[model samples]
Target: MNPIAANKAELIAIADAVAREKSIDRMIVIEAMEEAIQRAARARYGAENDIRAKIDPRGGDLRLWRVLEVVEEPEDYFKQISLVDAKERESDVKLGDFIVDPLPPIEFGRIAAQAAKQVIVTKVRDAERERQYDEYKDRQGEIITGLVKRVEFGHIVVDLGRAEGVIRRDQQIPREVLRVGDRVRSLITLVRRENRGPQIFCSRAHPDFMKKLFAQEVPEIYDGVIEIKACARDPGSRAKIGVLSHDSSIDPVGACVGMRGSRVQAVVQELAGEKIDIIPWSPETATFVVNALQPAQVSKVVIDEEDTRIEVVVPDDQLSLAIGRRGQNVRLAGQLTGHQIDIMTEAAESEKRQKEFVERSELFEKELELDETLAQLLVAEGFTSLEEVAYVEADELASIEGLDEDVAAELQSRAVEALERRESGYRDARRALGVEDALSEIPGLTEEMLVRLGSKGIKTLDDLADLSTDELIGKGDKRREIPAGLLASFGISQDDGNAIIMAARQHWFADEVTDEATEA
Candidate 1:
């Protein structure tokens, strides 16, 4: 059969048009068409033949060849040829080189032409998808607008001019109705390539979408005079953004808010009226946190940095506002600032203070056997722990509200007796638990720390070596976070936890190296 060739000018014109339309290289389209033509040619020849098609770029001349690689011996008939046979065709053919045998032109059959068309379409579509993915992957976090093409399953397929993106159901604002042909704006959250094609996933409810909206509306933000430090969203309801300004003249929050809420209102309209709080971010976490709970007026903020938590005290009238409806406000604030926020009213703080005072008063009453009035007096005078009482001078105790000099002497005696009794119990327990003296050699590991360690079954150096840093200086039973109180209790820094654990693990590591060397 004669090889079926299309018109040279027509083939070149089709490739150039397809390349322009698909936003892919013209050469890629030509290569794909060549592959399709090759497949059709292989169908007319035998499937067992190794076929390839080439189109001349200068003249658009199509040629077909059966490709055979030169080898020691001809491996099957289709793909490999003996070196001696290859040498007959070319005087100095190499063993690994391919020899091209020109085949007769293929005639266009109905089935063969359809097969060629299918291959071309498939490759062109694949190249189009790859181009779209590469183009949009860098556009991740950018805001783009598109017409709603259709909804499949729960995803909204958006026809973004040359390409399509999917806005998944969860990513859409909750209960915000959408319809086909509706114009929608979204942030490109993810672009992933899979076997079928590249998928561009979009999100309308993402916090970044709000950020991009602000950037578009506010000149200071877009021009880098102001920055959005952190953003959190309770999509379709409320959101918080922490902003900072490099220029002293620019108030970041005011810049985002615009004069008379013009700038922010534009963004709010796009977000389907999502309530947004624009806060000025601060380098001091307490100041940032205080600002994050906006409109509610935070009266005080206590931060525990190791636990990455902030306790926010607001006025009783502002309590509901600070927490928002269903605690959404504080929760989003926590997410934005990377801190666990606990919101409380001023009355609640006062109640907690009273409850703590009562507890400490009970501790003094139970531990020191002092009178009820005297225990209350000691607690009111700012003495909490028994150690404070035991360590203070007799004259210092006398200066308390109720105690006379003789009463102070008696109190000091009882305080020392109480501590000695507590320690004597710890000493007996330490000996019974078989805690080694070597553990005391660790710096900052007090006798009390050793006793606590012994109680937790970490009495020996090997036992300590097996413990993680979280177990040593962390009070976190869940989430494995280090709490400030635990760090302060040991008077150790965050890095010191790892250092102490490693100090115990030194022998273990040394033994491992020794065994490895011996094996070598």
Candidate 2:
């Protein structure tokens, strides 16, 4: 140790002060100062050049280690020393032996101080980045509350306590708005560690958010009394949640609805007025489907278990309600229940049946000496509708063991003729009943215009039946030209118009008009 070397106690104090000021660790500062001192010492003392120094901050003691090398001559100032100097530094020093010498100094030049400061800063920054990486990498998929710092390009940049998260525009719920400085709580969707920084991803539109919200709001769900089986949503529009209960005593729907709809309302408000329909889930496919189609009573639900399809039947009045406005209600129901739905009305079914009858009318008229069993089979196959049998495929009929293609074709042709005859009869009946087509042809009859005509006691085909074309033309009503032109266009004989009118009067007058006449 040399007196001019430096004060070790004073050097440790200076390094400690520098570490505290720069927010760098004291050990970092000590290491950096020691390296700087060793560089200066090698420049001064060319003897054993390998020299290093480190300071103990608490004890204020200096450690000295020498680097002794075996060589004929030194190559670098800091690395090698002459063999004579190496042996002088270490008595046992031999060829290729290494030594360490610690050098401590209190005084530092401007450049040295700057170099020391840079080293300490670099070490601390690297260590801090490693710490942050370790801390946040394990926090993925957790929930966190953060403040909205700014909105850029429709993305919400949230300032979480230790990191920032980006919520993209598409992830945001539709029709919802956010403001700066608002406290938003979201689930941490991802945590990515990169060399630059840790990227935290959070989401407000995750399905788990809805599930957790329900669990928080409904005690039945949280306490295991009621369980949420499945959920489907068109966010900010409507959501269908299927719920079941483990305990029969618990009503899942009632629990979700709360008294007067408070429980569901809380969730609705949080979702920005989105509608929530909590349906009771059932294991039976038919019963579950019936329940999913809420507010519309299902008369029947026929399930094809093999195909996983459901056909729903509703009454005539309920059909429109079941299908909903633009089919949105049933569509959501299908999504919730995972089934394909087809809706039908009783009136439509009956009309289909009547049309079938008209088509098949000639088949019954045919003197078919067919076996009773064949007739029964045809009837069972929906052939009662003459149209259905008229259009029956020959190959299909031949596929039946007892039927040949020629018989099928004959049956089809006869059934088709019968259907045509039935339609003609129906048309005649319409004319005889003073149907609007007949009246409209009689002229100047817009439904509204004819309604006015009816108001003036010029009602029905028969009332107009008694009057001639010339009589109508000369009557000089304001609508004369139209009436004359329309009457001529109808191209009907007086007898035909009169007969139709008489039939209509008899049919319509008996029940409705006769009673009204009596009352009058």
Candidate 3:
């Protein structure tokens, strides 16, 4: 009971009980006890005294001693002894050798016993936490069931049997309520071991949660016949999952849906009746995108592989279905397919095509001295701009069926003249607008873009740098909303837009330092 009175067997018994209760190794507990007793011995002797305790592994007998190194001259009196003094204690003792002086046992006082207990308890708890962390760290992304322990600041703390998991407010299923003692299933999103303990972060709204649920409901998925490729969820509203079958005979969708939707129904119920679309994954993005937008008949799919964009032309009746309510369906389809999708009705697409045709025809007519009939031919040949006719090889232009080499050459020369004149006029206008030529040097911005920015009172690099990428791209709203992105008409990419903005922002650092120096 009392420390120092407790013998070897009693110390070993205490270690065994502590290790069993904490789920740590008995040897770890024994080491902790030895360290605690060593600290107590140091306290009883002197603070500067180098004392140590070693517990016998077989019998757990405690041995206390003062450890001092043999040195030529005693620098510190507590931990070092002169070689002469050490040689007197042991005839064969050499310099730098540690001399262990056995100390007589002393009773551990109230304070000393409490210090030892704290040390043992702290060590055992650390060992337990370490074990828990190791046990659940590898279980990340796996679905685990737990009871809701409590809710604090919208965070749900779930009580796993051994280690607790936390589901932050954003990770919970939307509109799904939880109460203490309510059992819930969640996918482990992340796991971290900190000084406090292992923090197992879980999520019910994660797309992986739905994937795991389907894995549980469908046998083929677990057996590796069906593989869930990608998943997108709107929490309690809707979800889309792309599945592929390694075994051709097994229809991945049919296997996941089960008989009369039995398997999918089970998963849907678990997700609070969220609607799910099981899409057959395809390597061809167009086919996969068409599959992703299910229940909506696609009349035609035009895929822009370079942009990873899919244009789905649905019938007039299917447009609403293809786009979904508030664009959620199409958005989720894009996410699942990993492509940007543009949904248009057949009628709307035809109208857009006609509009583009007229625009291209007019461009050729004015720029290449082509009449309606001649411009119509160029438009039919898919020559969208005069610049293309001017820049492309003569053979490419001549290859357009009826246009001979002489005619093609003449048209190209006219196009070059027209574009040069147009560019000269744009340069004059830019100067008139007081827009910097430096801004026009940016990769994505054109003369027209400079004029637009200048008209908006952005004339300098400083002014341009003050604006966001969205504003430069025309996506950001000013007094009026520009629904389309910046330089959208000029076909600027988001990456190019970001690069242009960054170019504009290069002067920002210089300007900042100048202003700071001025203020100082």
Candidate 4:
């Protein structure tokens, strides 16, 4: 073969090799070469020329051109040509037509060759980075095994065959040492396209890492016979998984634990001996919470669904065990159950109940002019509020051991009078706070609610209307130091709060309609 043909074959061979090595399209590498050549030609000829370059993909035939526009009169001589002169190149040329003028091949100098090579390298690298990002972006939540490439600033850089992933310091299992060439498995938590390249962030400390490990060890999980519903981890210390089974015969916890603890042990080893608790998951929140706090006997569980909180009562001796070392057990249980758990001993729970009982009895005695014995009797029968006393069926009250119908009637009358007096006091306080009477006209605005709203500087209809339902009645964020809704203590539901705000804004709509009428 001649030297020119040899060089063309070599060019095609180089493009093939680059495409294979970079795992990019052969067309992309050829395009990069074209751009590099075009840049070099522009430097050789003139920077102001509209130069372009192209190479045949089948057999590397290089070509160069200077594009010029046909205009009535050429102002930019390098890029624009007169229509009369354009007719010499092409008889059919018209105004505004773009024509390409063929040019000779460029002989690259040493410096120009280096600059062209740099352009090609940069383009190929950018294409490779884009391919890496696209390949791994959807691979998040997957478990990948990789070799530890290096450690930088306590973060582990892993070689994942096609890409490099980073396990941040906080994402690694605590106290677990990793060295170069160590085989480690991690969950792909994030894949971000950054200026440098695609950032594949892996995590061994995430709860899903434990779940994925279980999925690997337990075939039942892999086949969808059992599913991991919830997981909580304390890094290298301990982890808990809540598993559920679709098939009735397959017990989720037992399947995850395996025969004689083989499956769970495999996962435990991978996690650096992080103890694993595979609990059977339940749809009932109480049942799930009870199972999550394992090894500790629980006497009772009181769940406040509105607050997403649980009060757990355990035996006095099991307090430390239920709470674990530094409250790790309860904390993991809370995370797994998705509830704020408060654990207490049986004695403490009893003391709380007694305290509430005394407070309610005293309220009845003071508000109803009742004797201590009668108030205690009312509390014992589950009548804890004045509203309950005033609104309860008269027959139910009369059935009490020491109360007749006449006594029940008198008790209800006194309860009503007491509630009215309390409401009057709240109204007086609300008025003193400069709250407008217009706020009282809105539905769901009670004297007590008005007083609370006044204290929060929501004394006018516009102020109340400006608030969202969540802001009016949401259980505020404790972490953010945001106070709870003004009517949250009153147990106002979300629907009620929305209705109240809409009612407050009714006047605004009325004013709009009135102005429209007056203009008409």
Candidate 5:
């Protein structure tokens, strides 16, 4: 068959069309076509030697060059031309130069055409994958909204604008129901490269959902006027957000709450109805901590500087509220406030006789040469009982700011002297109530045990001391992770727990009644 004339115009137009359709450079298509044509021509029958093909755009001609050597050895048989053969083609020719011979019509069989087509498809696919990877690799930690494509094996696949994302089972709220084609918003947790496509990891159960909600609903937060300083959450159950305002005129808490609680309510709805608490951020540890534990008023805040702990006390009615159903409130509050918060009820305080000492704290502060703030700090650091502080070394107190060695020494001496004198006072107070031997008569506790307990500030037999085996032994499943077996070793039982708690309450009432009678 005769060779088809080179259609240069058709070749250039096809290259441009392919480049535009495939989103590739026109020069790449031109190079691919040249490779296809050269491979086809070189593989034609009886032309197995090395043959190079070139297209002349000016004249629209396809030229073929056959390379051959002049050496007798012909190391490369296909490319060698003997001296005699070279002279036959050209009377005056060099021995070492390659010969150029014209090639016959070049065409490809079915197998060669299939191989060329496959090469083009593979090259275009690789280019597309690289382009997609470049577009999405930097969008980490941002929120993206997309349509739910389908669910596969408990994982939700979402169709993002330029790519797809997978919401793994663990990143979804437990028992939450979703449907196909529904729109969902999630945080982009990770972006990964795969052979087939870009793998994006998304989450709806992240604690940052609270912060993202505020950013969407609150104008102040959206505009950078208010910043979400920190957040702690239990995902679908509850969340606490700490917000600070750059502009004093705008209140971060009020902004998060919105008008009549619209903003927070909207966020709660989006989170499968999770409860949210918005607390104002504070630079001061004491004030920030108090605000962090909201809906539960703190009667006193003790800062334990040495241990980085803060003990918060609430009234009897607010104990359950402060701790939430299973200590969730205090746990999240502690995480948000960056402190270890210990919550206790008023009943516990009365049993420990902490109230009596709590009242006389001011007087002790004065006698001990400590400010009220410093005294509170000392109490917060596990030195709740006055006797503990009385025995503290002067150097130890001096280690704390504002308490010099001389002042700590003087305070220790005075507190010890007062403890000696107050021993008789306590005995007299107990005797006047007619139950002077009540504590010593308890089933398993000895005098030494009672004293050790008192030193830890467990002076009374109220609910705090009267804890039942289950109440004391129940391991916290969610937050505290307490062990049940540990509380059994103590001489604490259900019947005695109730009786001791009642006796402690009665003693407290008796003391209050006598004080009133004496005043009258």
Candidate 6:
């Protein structure tokens, strides 16, 4: 009934109201009030004093204390007290003990009340931000519906019930107009904790956004009967999804498309009229690439797994359709299949094959002193390289039409001689480039590879060892104009490159072991 008792009751009521309005814990508000009181007490008492404040959550009874350490020597008079002096306050006080001194409650002045209010506001805001972050951090990749709060610099700010999310300009569906107060659904792509607060970034243009939409529309996807293996989107224009069915009876593409195209239509509408292609996913890379380039019939698919590239040969009439307008179709196919796709007409593919045939035949004729007819015959029988002829089973070569065992033996002898001459030439070229013989001793590095490395200024064993596997045999970034690796042209695998580098570094380990043994 007194003024102090009435103030305590009013404090408890305020804390409850703030906690409810902010949707934060009541204890957090009480703690914020305690901090505010502590700040005010510091202003009232000397700033040097170690003052702390506590408020009873149940009764709202405020308490203030000066915390001091008991020490043999009290250098900081406000924070430390001598053991003898501390005993005057507490009989059980010992050196290095932290003890609190109770202080009289002071009435709040106008300036102190304003400062306390600011502190409470700041603390409550910080608690609210932390709660929002914790609540939404795990909600990433989820589809969230919100009202369009505002637009700034082409970015959409959405009012998610408990938090605000931003749809960056690049994350919005192209040419899809959204106005204030309109309901919008987007995928929570990112949640970042920054100095300002937790940033919730939403996206309607991302491929995952379409996949989530499909999950909502298709019951099979939601229940895990069907899985979205891969997705690629061109924003408001078109999108492709590779779906796989766990249950064979339920076709993934059919389930996603739904009866009468209802499910896909729903997703298409949500994505601002984006056309959706629901392709059945395949485990085989070549089959998957062929499926990804839908609507355009593909005659053949040649996949280079090492480079993650696919070459599709289509009918000349379907060339424009296969490549799409402005190359969008092939680009989306590449994205969905995770491979770089090259589309060529059937005629072009045939022409390329003929050109390669002639080139191989000419190589055999020039290198092995073979007549044109025999060299052409060798190329036709799939003998593309000198090494293949030299190392292949003699019976296999003799089994070729019109080639007896004696002819097969003679051809292999010529191939071996030609390979040896090439190796000798490359060795001389490598030495001329100042490449160390130690480099050739590395397991995977041949004389030709050493010449390439030396031309690139990688002549020493240490220089070769210092290079990464990707640097040794990577298909370099074309966009960045980076040259491919020294052994890239030789079709060296990543494992081979790694083995070569390790072999080059073997001597380093040997020297280390020898030095340690010498020291011992």
- For residues 180-204, write the lDDT of model 3, one tens digit per residue: 9999999998999999999999999
Where model 1 places Cα greater than 4 Å from the true spot, the runs are: 1-5, 47-50, 67-100, 108-111, 358-520
Please rank every candidate by lDDT, starting with the best.
4, 6, 3, 1, 5, 2
Candidate 5 residues lying further than 4 Å off, grouped into runs, are 1-106, 304-309, 349-520
Cα distance off (Å), candidate 6, residue 21: 1.4
Candidate 2 local lDDT, 97-156, one digit each (tens): 775655544465556555555555565556555555567678766667889999999999
Report the C-alpha lDDT of model 1 over 478-505, residue by residue, as the tens digit. Answer: 2344442333355455577778888887
Give the per-residue lDDT of model 6 (tens digit) for 1-520: 1222236778888889999999999998888888878878888897899999888888878888999999999999999999998899889888989998899998867787788888888888999999999999999999999999999999999999989999999999999999999999999999999878899999999888888888889988999999999998899998889999999888888888888999899998998899988899999988888899998999999987656778899999999998998999999999999888999998899999999999999999998888999999999999889999999999999999989999999999999999999999999999999998988777777898888888899989789879887788774422112355666777776667778889888989999999999999
Model 5: per-residue Cα lDDT over 1-520, one tens digit each:
1112336666666666777776667666656666566666666644567777665543435666677878766676787978887888888887787788887655667776666556655666666566667777897777889999999999999988657898999999776788998999898888888998778899988877567777889888889999998899887888888889999888888888988999999999888888888888898888888888888887877787644578777898888888887889999989998778888776776565566556556656765656788766666554655577787766777677666888777767878876766665655544444333556566554444444344444454563345443444333222123444223334454555456445545767888999999999
Number of the top candidate by lDDT? Answer: 4
lDDT of each: 0.83, 0.68, 0.86, 0.90, 0.71, 0.88
TM-score of each: 0.76, 0.53, 0.85, 0.89, 0.58, 0.89
Model 1 superposed RMSD (Cα): 5.7
Worst 10 residues of 5 by lDDT: 472-481
Ranking by TM-score: 6, 4, 3, 1, 5, 2
Instruction: Give the higher-TM-score candidate: 1 or 6.
Output: 6
The list of candidate 4 runs beyond 4 A from truth reads: 1-6, 96-98, 392-410, 453-488, 491-520
lDDT for model 1, please. Answer: 0.83
Which residue pairs clash within candidate 6? none
Clashing residue pairs in candidate 5 (N, C-alpha, C atoms within 3 angstroms):
69-79, 69-80, 69-81
TM-score of 2: 0.53
